[model samples]
Structures are given as C-alpha cells and as structure tokens.
Target chain A: MTVLVFLDPRHPEGRIADAAAPALLATDLGATRGDGVFESMLAVGGQPRKMGAHLDRLAASAHTLELDSPDRGAWERAVATALSEHLLRAGTGEAVVKLLLTRGAEGSDAPTAWVSVSPVPAGARERSSQGLAVVLLDRGYDSTLAERAPWLLLGAKTLSYAVNMAALRYAKANGADDAIFTSSDGKVLEGPTSTVILAVEEDGVKTLLTPELESGILPGTTQRALFDAAEAAGWALGYGPLEPVHLMEADAVWLVSSIRLLAPVTSIDGTPISSSPALTEELTALLHEAL
Target chain B: MTVLVFLDPRHPEGRIADAAAPALLATDLGATRGDGVFESMLAVGGQPRKMGAHLDRLAASAHTLELDSPDRGAWERAVATALSEHLLRAGTGEAVVKLLLTRGAEGSDAPTAWVSVSPVPAGARERSSQGLAVVLLDRGYDSTLAERAPWLLLGAKTLSYAVNMAALRYAKANGADDAIFTSSDGKVLEGPTSTVILAVEEDGVKTLLTPELESGILPGTTQRALFDAAEAAGWALGYGPLEPVHLMEADAVWLVSSIRLLAPVTSIDGTPISSSPALTEELTALLHEAL
Candidate 1:
C-alpha cells in the first residue's frame, strides 16, 4: 500500500512532490526505525477522540526516548489536514489514524513527525461485542520507575514491534484470539494485543485495572478516559496488581484501546463467562462525551 | 542470486529438496509473518567455517523463540548446497550466506525454513583496512543482561533488523560510520552497529571486553572465536561495562563480525586515534583459523 506521510511535518508536501517515502527520507528516521514515538487515535466522524490527551501522552513518550516535543501546532495541523483529506475523499465517519514521530537527521535532537489514516482493522468490532479470548504469557519486563527507564522504548509506540507481533502469534497458536501479558512472578500483566483488562465488581464499583507501573506494559490512552468516566458516573475507580483469578470473577472484561473503545473479553483459556453490557455502554458514552 | 542449499546436512540434495526454502507445498507462514529464526554465515571458498557451531547456535536461538529446530544432519546438507551454488556461480571464496529455521506448519507452530546467499557487502574489506568513526547512543536498552535477555531477539538472527539499521543511521548522521550503545545509566555497552569493543592492555594482557550478560548485547561469533584463539595463544580475555572514557583512552579498538573479521576503530566521538597493527594481526589470525 502506498502510504501518504509527512517526511518533514514542517513541510509535508515537499516530500510528497519529491516522491520521497517517509521511511526512505533522511529526517523520517524514527517512524521506520521505531526510534521516536507514536499515538494511535480513534476517529468518530471527522474529529479525533481525545486528541489533546493523546498529544500529552505522546510528549511524555518522546521525553522517554530523549526526543524533543514535536511542535504540537504542526502535529495539530497535520492531523486536521489528514482527517479533512480523508473526509473529502472516502467520507467515512469511522476511522483510525496514527501519528508517528521519528528522530531526524538534524543530529539526534531533530524532531520529525508524520500522520496517516487507515480503515479500522477487521475483527475489532466483533471482538468488542463477543469479547476476545486470551492467553496470559509473562513478557518478563520490569516496569519499576518506568518514567525514568529511559533505556526502553517502553511507553512510547516505537516502530520496533516484532516482539508485539510475536506475542499475538503466541496467543493464536495457543487457541486464543489475543494474549494478555504477565510478569514472570505470576502477576497478571496487560494483554499482548491490548491494554489493561478491565473488570467491574458486583458492588457497582467500576474498576480500571492493569499491570502496575512496574509491569512493563505500555500505559493506555483509552484506559485513562474510562477511569475518569467511571469516577464521574459515581463508581469507585482503582488500579491494582490484578491476578488471573481476580479477572475470571469480575463483572465484565474489556481490552481498551483508541480504536476499540472497550473490547469486552468473554473467555480466558477457553472458559466462558457472562458479558456485562452496562459497563461497556457507560464507558463508550463517557468516551464520546470526553472526545 | 539463485543459490544452492543443503536440505539436511546429511542429504546433500539426493534426499530433502527443501534445502534452504521449504517445499512450496508446505504451509506458508514464515514469509508473511516473519515467524522464525535465522543465522548469517560468512562462507569462504567451498566450506563454511564453524558451520557446526553456527548450526548449534541457530538451534539454541530457535529454542529461545520457541520455534522447532531442523535436524543437524539435514541442516548441514542444506547449507553445503547453498555454499556450492554460490561458488558455482560467483567462483569467489568471498561470500556471505544466511540459514533460516521456522516452525513447520505440520502442527500448531508457525512453520517454514529456508536459506539465501548473496555476495559479501561491498566496501567491507576497504572499511576494515581504514577504520570507521563511531558515535554512541542509548538503545533504550540496558547493555547488561542483553546477551541473554528473554525479550531480546539478541543472539537469534530474527527477521527484525530495523533497530540495527537505525543504529547505523545514527552513527552516519553523527559524522561517524557507526554507533555504540550504552546502558541507560551512561555505561558504554555494545555498538549499535556491531558487537561490543576490544583493545590490548599495554601491560600485555590481551583484552576484548564487552558488556556482561546483563548488558543486553548480542555475543558476536567473531568475538567468541577471538576469545578462544586468544586463550590458546596464551592471552587472557575479559569483558566490561566499558565507559566512553575507558574506550577513548584505550591503546587500540576494533569491531568484530564473521564477514568483517576485524574493522579497526580510527576515531571515536570526533577524536583521532592511531591504528594498531599488532592488535589487528592477532585478531586476523584468530578469525582466519576459526573460519
């Protein structure tokens, strides 16, 4: 597929007219190398959901990679342009767009950024309704002091996604739709294919749980929005060192991401459970309003 | 680049025709998904030096990735065929070949395996004669434990080469030919572009040090061969948490790899250092005998 990208977000067209692939251009280093950072956003209609928060988190991710904050205005304009272009051409209200930041050739400090659009991947919606069957594997990451663990591309959506793909492959081979990663110590970690697994309690407490900061999972963008909604809706919200047994007994299970607002999970290890619609319903309403 | 490969080390082609590439009838998994392990060997003349050791390491790497290994006998024949084919066409002793192993599709594993050969990359010899300059960076990788890190496709020559290419780009942009990696704490690690470094202590202890098992650096085949040879030649070997300062002050430096035996370090971080012939002589002899 021919991808349209901004080699220099500062002057994106210069690259397009010159026919320079973002991956091939000198400044567009981080995107292809998975060097810099990235944020995947869900678009309902023409506007991106939670644009500001995603940008905020992207800044933190860049700092982790020791890169400068790419100009927010430039990024803002690029997204607006890409989305508007999408609307003008395809006219699809449902979309998923990705913003990728790469280290530039202007030395290690040069900031480079790009944005692209694509249709939502297949199976995300059905899985959201039916829930994903998952396997929990220990990714063996130490996420302690995660903010200061600059030696990792951890929180940042870097391009080095071989491990991530491998994790998904492992899940499929194990007869699961996706995987939930855990630590070596049997502590429940995030899913290999998604963010923290969320489950509600019988007392009407909406809990937002995933691996703690020490679990080496990429902090979730959509997960935070739901946590806020859970609180506003008068449900108790909390984070925990959730074990697999705890997840098995929860009121509902969902894999949160920008594209799939909350993909509720119905089974784990082939064990089926009842699905909770109220939690996913409230989460989506709050997310739409937040957007 | 059509080349021959041994299907199994023993068959040598009268048996398994799959040699490097599996039969087309076999389930196709590796090509699209990149789900397998591979090793690149530097074969000179008609023989692959350390071929047995290379195959052994390939199996070890496969085990780490949870992929099935090919029979030693079958693998050897496939490799021999690959070498013979390259020699038949190129008529050159100088060559580089790759061996690949993937889980076969017979069962639940992602299966496929094959081999490919190409001429040695150009300018390799010239670059070795006149050392390349280097810049250092953090791979978001702790150089410690990298040698055996679980998440690391480190020692395994997996399909993921994006980071390796980025390392080279980082070095070239810094006005150097390569980049050295370090721990997040600024402890010098391995070269982003190559293996850990080496030098001779003026006190006569032959030293070729890299980061420890915890440093997350891949153990180079050339480094291993050199160490064994150094030991046989009555020189002691050591590894290190080599700091940038320690390297700048070293009497000599060189990068080791199977294809490029020993490339000298002409300068580091912009400071010029005179090349040492004595160090190069010992390393060349060591690699030559091993290959």
Candidate 2:
C-alpha cells in the first residue's frame, strides 16, 4: 500500500489522495517530457530521515531545470501528512518516502508537487544484507563535460532516467545484479540509483572514498551523512577521479543509497572480489546512527 | 480542446477519456522514472500524416527500453478515435496527435497506452512561417559513443527528455528561439526536438544533406519524406559527419519535425546565416505532396 499527499495552496497540511486511483493528467509534462525533479529517502517509525538534505537537493535540481519549487514548509507538511497516512494504513516500520515535482500539465503555468510513502521493497533489504554483483557500463560523458555543459543537467536528479534504467537492465541481462557507470574518459562513476563507495586501508589508516562531484554524478545525501559519521568516528575520507582499479584493490566496496543503506558489491564482471562483513557491519551501524 | 483515447484490451475501438481530468496514476513509471516512449505527428482534416514511420520508430524505441508495446492496430484505432473526437469538438484544421506508452504504475505488469489530439500551438505555426534563430549546444556525448553504448538509448525517443527541454530553455534564455545539439567531438547533431537539414547548390547542382544516423540522431520522418521527394525532382542527397561550418556554408538550413513541418533557420548562435525563402517554399511543397 502507498499513501500520497499533494501540496496545495488551498490546504495547509496537504491534500491526501488515493494512490490506487488516477491522480495525474495525461498531458502532465512529468509524464510527457519528463520535465521534473524527485527525491527519495527512508522513513523509520513513521518519521522521515535526512529530509532537509533531500529537499535541498530537490531545490537544486529544480533550479538547474529553471523550475519553480514550492516552499520548504509546504513540502515538510506534505511529507508529514503522507507518513502519518502510511502509518495509519500499514503501521510503517521502515517506509520509503518520495517527493516529486513536475512542470505540470501542458499549457498550464502551475507546477505539480506531491509526496508519497510506501513500504520498503523486499529486494532492497535482501541486497543490503546479501552482497550482489555489478557490471561497469560507459555513461557516455567525459568527467570534465559537466562543468562546460550545464544544459546536460548531469548533477540534477531529474525525471529523465531512461538511460540509467536501461543501464541497470543491461547489467541484469548480462548476469549482474546492478551497474556502475564509468565515464567516457574511464573515470569511475556512480551506480544507476546509488553512490559508489570504497574502503581503503593502507598503513593502518582506514578511509572512505567516493567519486568527485565534478564527475557529473548526483550528490548522494546518504554518502554525505555516512562520510560525516565516519569522519567523527576516526575514519579518513577521500574523493576521486577514481577508476575501476580502485574498486578491485579496495578492502571493501559498497553501493549506498537512502533505502538501501549499504549494499556490498561481491563481484565485478563475474570476478569475485574481497568483501569484509565486519567493515560492512561497522559502516552500517555508523550510517544508522548518523540517520 | 484536447481529446484522449486509451488503448484497452476490452475496447477494440479504444476508450475515450476526459483529457482535463486525472487519467494517469501518480505512481506510473512514465511520470516517476520517465520509463516510456512517445511519438507526435500532425493530422490534417482528421488524418494523421506519416503515421507508419512514427509507429515504426515508436516500436523501436519501446524495444530499446525493453517495454511491451500495444499492437499496432490498437494504436491505430486509438489515434483514429482521438482524431475523430478532436474533429467533433474543435472542427479540425490541423491537430497534433500524440501516442504515448508507459511502463505502468509501480509494480503493475500492464503498460499504459494512449492517444491524444489537440490543436497545433500558435507558436509552432509562427516559427514555421517566420524563420527562427537557433543556438548550438553541446549534447555531452561523442558521435561514436552511441554505437558502442547501446544502453545509453541514444537512438530511442524515450520520455526522458529533461535535457532536451533544458537545452531549449537555455536557448530561449540566451536570446535564441531554438537549440541545435552538437556532439562533444564537434559533429553537428539534430535539434532538441527537430532534425537538421541543409541544402547546397554548387555549380547549379542542387543537393540535400543531413547528419549521418551513426551520429545517434533520431531519424527524422519529415527529413526522409523531403529527401525522397527532392531526389525524385533530381536533387542529389548526401549524409554527413557534418560540422557547424557545413551548416554555415550551405545555401539554406532548416529544423524540421512532424508538427512544425519545415522551419527555416534564419541564424545560428546569434550570427545571421544564409536562408532562402524560395528553397523553403519549394521543399515545403514537395514535403506536403509526399505526405
């Protein structure tokens, strides 16, 4: 079951809508041209986590697209409404909360904004506990292209994710569970819906490394939280111009996201790699505490 | 006024729906993930033009996305029903007919397919009659990447068009009317929503040219029709690994699409270039005859 709430001027708390019923016009640019922005985060015990960061990213995405966004208060209220509705309907333990904003229907000036809450999928939980395999695919953009071409909207989490979805499908069809995109210049990038993180232990120094933000990947909110927590806990942090070699040589690698907190990657291209269960447990604990 | 017709298994003639009301679920992946394909064509007196080409391309796009497409007959019936409904409501002069197919709501296996017919926007007609200025933008992908990275879905017209829309918005914000995308490797690509066509007349030999399909541009149905008619009229045809210099050197340049038809490019990147009213007229006539 899913609970939905729309941010409306007429309703201060948000207008609850039936998720199973039709609630969007056919001509909405979100459905037609994919002119929109979205963010998804996890909710525990009917309370949303890291919502401020998600809202900030969503606003940045809207700004990149030149889309008008609702005020933060409206979004907060809508999220609250959706979460309460979810708790009432399903007594949520762990729920996935999503915020969506579109350019609205054709010829209309008003934008469409909504919040949705649903139960966490079983696959995500299973993947987080049991390590999975991933394939590296070319993202078709050089690492430096993002700075030169702002119209590409590379860092924005827009609704135009068909290529990302295709890459994931390609990985699964090729005998992998997920994909990690590599730049045309051969720099390591993020996964379809997650951030690529690697742990390097050299000379007794444990460090967490992620691809640099300049590489045109979305800024991962969960990664940020995890990095902050890890740093406070005496773990070093680094950013890169990372390559696949780094993953191959790392002490452990993970694909991290809000819903799937930390999913350890067991192999790449059918070749088994080193994975440390103790490190996974430690990071997961830090991440949960940070959230 | 807009008229909508949905392709339903129980309704062989298609089911008519109110376009102004909510007709799509908010959870539909087309709105959420932009995981879908679409086609738009112009209809004259309730008859859609170049429908066969559009349908073929739609099927190809769905295949690339691994989406299940409704049978061609179902789409045909839906389009006919929409056009007829549009005629009844608006007394058709020229209507824009769109075919949309989405990977249904959330976890549902069924796809959502529909046809919509609406009157042509006045801006499109104005742009076609009075040539518009265009800006050259980088598409962030090299011309050769498409062939190597099929998962990028470069050749498919998917619903994930946020970048395309952003490019157009950027052009307008920069004092241009439209945008023409160029590959990162400096090869001339197509426009955000149209195909680039150029005419060269050297030593009294008239020729038509378009960028090669290998450059990962969407094959223009209007361009194909015009080229066929021009060839029958003894005009030579050529394909290119074209550069912006080629466009500057051509006698005439145009951005053509199904709805806007043949819109001549008056200038590129704020620089006034060569344009021919005579050529535009002649080609428009040929294209109409072919259609």
Candidate 3:
C-alpha cells in the first residue's frame, strides 16, 4: 500500500490523493518525455531523513531541467501529509518517501508536484545485510564531459533513468547483484543507483574514499552523512578521481544509498574480494546514529 | 481534445479511457524511471501513417528494453479505437498518434500500453514550412561507443529523452530553433527529435546522404520512407559517417521525422546555409506520394 499527496497552491498542506487509483494524466511530460526530477529518502517513525540534502538536490535538478519548482515548504507539508498517512495505515517500520515533480501535461506550463510514501522493498534490506556481487560497467561518458556538457544533465537526478535501469539489468543478467559505473575515461564514478565507497587502513589510520564530485556522480546524501559521522569518530575522509584499481586494492568496498544505507561488496566480476564485517558493523552503527 | 485507448487482453478492441482524467499510476515506471518505449506517427484523414515502420521500431525498442510488448494486433486495434474517437471529435484533420508501453508500476510485471490521439501541434507544420535555425550540441559519447555499449540503449527509442529535450531547450535558449547533436568524436549525429538528411547535387545527379545506422541514432521512419521513394525516383542514396563539414557543404539539409515530416534547415549555429526550394518541393512531393 502507498499514500500520495499533491502540492497544490489551493491546498497549502497538500491534497492527499488515492494512490491505488490513477493519479497522473497520460500526457504528463514526466510519463511522456521523462521531463521531471525526483528524490527518494528513507522515513523512520513517520519522519523523513536527510530531507535537506534531498531537497537541495531536487532543486538543483529542477534548475538543470529549467522546470519550475514548488517551494521547499510546500514539499515539506506534502511529505508530512503522506508520511503521517503511511504511519496511520502501515505503522511504518521503514518507508520510502519519494518527492516527484514533473513538467505537467504537454503544452501546459504548470508543474505537477507530489509526495508518495510506501514501505521499503524487502529485497533492499535483504541485500543490505547479505552483501552484493558487483560488476563494473561503462557509463559511456568521460568524466570531464560534465563540465563541458551541462545539457547532458549528468549531475541532476532526473526521471530519465532508462540507461541506469538498463545497466542494473545488465549486471543482474551477468550474475552480479549490482554494478559500479566507470567513466569512459576509466575513472570510477558511482553505482547504477548508489554511491561507491571504499575504506582503507594504513599505519592504523582509517579513511573513507568516494569518487570526486567532478566525476559527474550524484552526491550521495547518505554517503555524505556517513562521511561526517566517520570524521567525528576520528576517521579520515578522501575524494578521488578514483580508478578501478583503487577499488580492487582497497581493504573493503561498499555501495551506499538512502534506503539501502550500506551494502558491502563481496565480489567483483566473479573474483573474490575482501569484505570487512567489522567495518560494515561500525559504519552501519555510525550511519544509524547520524540518521 | 484527446483520445486514449489502452491495450488490454480482456478488451480486444481496447479499453477507452478519459484523457481529461488522471489515467496513469504515480508509481508507474514510465512516470518514475522512464522505463518504456514509444512511437509517434502522424494521422492523415483519421488514418495513422507509416504505422508498419513505427510498430516495427516500437517492437524493436521493447525487445531492447527486455519489455514484453502487446502484440502488433493489440496495438493496431488500440490505435484504431483512438483514431476513430479522434476523428469523431477533431473532424479528420492532421493528428498525432502515439503508442506508449511502460514497464508498469513498480514491482508489477504487467506492462501499461496505450494509444493517445491528439491534434498535431500547429507549430510542427509551421516550422516545417518556415525551416529551422539549428545549433549543434555534443551528445557526449564517441560515435563508436554504441556497438561496444549496449547498455547505453543508443539505438532504442526509449522514453528516457530528457537529454534530447534539454539539447533542444539549450538550442532555443541560445537563439536557435532546433538542435543537431554531434558525437564526442565530432561525427554528426541525428537531431534532438529528428534525423538529419543532406542533399548533394553534382553534374545534374542528386545524392541523398544521412549518418550511418552504426552511429547508434534512432532509425527514422520518415527518413527511411523518403530514402525508398527517392531511390525509386533515380536519386542516388548514401549512408554517412558524416561530419559537420558535410552538413555545411551540402546543397540542402533537412531534419525528418514522422509527425513533423521534413523540415529544412535555413542556418546552422547562426551561419546562413544553403537551402534549395526546388529540392524541397520535389522531395516533399515524393514524401507525400510515399505516405
């Protein structure tokens, strides 16, 4: 079951809509041209987490697409409406709160903004605990292309995700559970739907490393929160124009996202890789505390 | 006014739905991930044009996405239902018939397939006659990347067209009417929503040229039909690994697509280019006869 709320100017607190019923016009550009932006965050105990980061990214995405956005307050109220409904009916163990805004029906300038709250998929949590067998896939863009080609919308989390979904399908078909995307120039970028993080220890100093933001990967909110938490716990942090070799040489690698939180990678392209359970437990605890 | 007919197994003719009302689930993958395929064809005198080519391409797109498509018969019936309704209300003027197939709502195997019929945008025909001022934009992939990376879905006409739409927006923002995409390696690619065609005449013999299929552009149904008619009319035809220089040097250049037909290019990047009214008239006649 899911709950939906629409950000309507006439309804300052949002208009709760029936999710089981049809809720989008067939001509909505979001369904037609994929002309939209979205954010998905985790909700615990009826409260959304890292909403500031998600909303910031959503605004940036809307700006990139040149779509008008409902102000942050409208989104906050709508999300609250949806989450409160979710808790009422589902008693939220954990829910996925999705904020979606689309350039409305074709030929219309009004943007359609909505909030949807649903239970987190069971498979996501299962994979989080069971770990993932991963493969590296080419994202077909040179890292430097982002700076030169803003029209590509590389930094925006737009609704145009067919290639991302295709990459994940390709990975699953190849016997891998997930994929890490590499830039055409051979730099480690991010995963199909998450950020790639690697940990290392040298001279008894621990460090967390993620691909540099310049590589055109979506800045992971969960990853950002965990990095801050790790820093406070006295762990060093690094960003990279990282290569696959760094991942292969690291003490451990993980894919982190809002809902999945952190999923350790146990293998790469069928080759066994080190998985640090202790590090996973430590980071998971840290992430929980941060949330 | 618009008409929508959904292809459902229980309804051999289609399930007609109100286009004015909400008709798609918010969680539909087409709305969220753009995980789908679509074809847009023109309707003349209430009959869809080039439907065979469009349906073939739609099936190919569905296959590439690993989506289960409703059979050709189902699509045919749904399109008929939509067109019949369109003719009733719109009086058989030119219309656009769009076939859409989505991966359905999340966690569901069902595919959402529908046909929408609406009057053709007046601007499409106006621009076809006025010609377009086009700007070139980088598509951010090497020309050769298509074959090596099936995950890019380069050849498939999927619904994830945000980049394509953005390129057009960029062109319009920069004072051009439309955009022509160029690969990272400087090879001339297709236009944002159409295919590029150039004409060269020497010694009274005419040759039609377009970028080769291997460049991973969507195969243009109008371009293909025009090529067949032109070949039958004794014009030479050529496939190209074309560069921007080829477009500049050609006697005439046009962008061709199903709904907009053939639209000539008057200038590229603000530089006046050659345009041949005689060739445009002759080709337009041929395209009409072919259709």
Best prediction by lDDT: 2
Worst 10 residues of 2 chain B by lDDT: B120-129
Classify candidate 2 by CAPRI docking class: high
Best by DockQ: 2
| Tens digit of per-residue lDDT, candidate 1, span A1-291 | 112346464474413211121132211233213455567787778888888888888887776556676567767777777777778766866777777665653234555556766567777676666677876665544345344433445555554555666677667877887777665456776764467656667564556666575555777777777777767877676676777887788777787788877888788888985568876787778877766
For each candidate in turn, the TM-score is 0.62, 0.99, 0.99
Model 1 spans > 4 angstroms off: A1-3, A7-23, A26-33, A105-112, A143-148, A202-204, B1-154, B157-219, B227-281, B288-291
Tell me chain A's TM-score in each of the predictions.
Answer: 0.86, 0.99, 0.98
Error of 1 at B93 (Å): 19
Give the winner by DockQ: 2 or 3: 2
Q: Please state the Cα-based DockQ of model 1 relative to the true two-chain complex.
A: 0.09
In Å, candidate 1's interface RMSD is 10.6
How would you encode candidate 1's per-residue C-alpha lDDT over B1-291 as one tens digit per residue?
Answer: 435342443454523232223232211223223345667677777777677777877887777677777677667766676777778778876776767654433224534455556677788777766787876666554444444335445555654444566457556755788767766567876665457556757675666666564565666776777778877877767777678777787777777677777788888788877568877886788678756
Best-to-worst ranking by DockQ: 2, 3, 1
Docking class of 1: incorrect
lDDT of 2 by residue, A1-291 (tens): 989899999999999999999999999999999899999999999989999999999999999999999999999999999998888889957999999999999999999999999999977767656997999999989999999899999999999889988998999899899999999899999999999999999999999999999999999999999999999999999999999999999999999999998999999988888899999999999999998
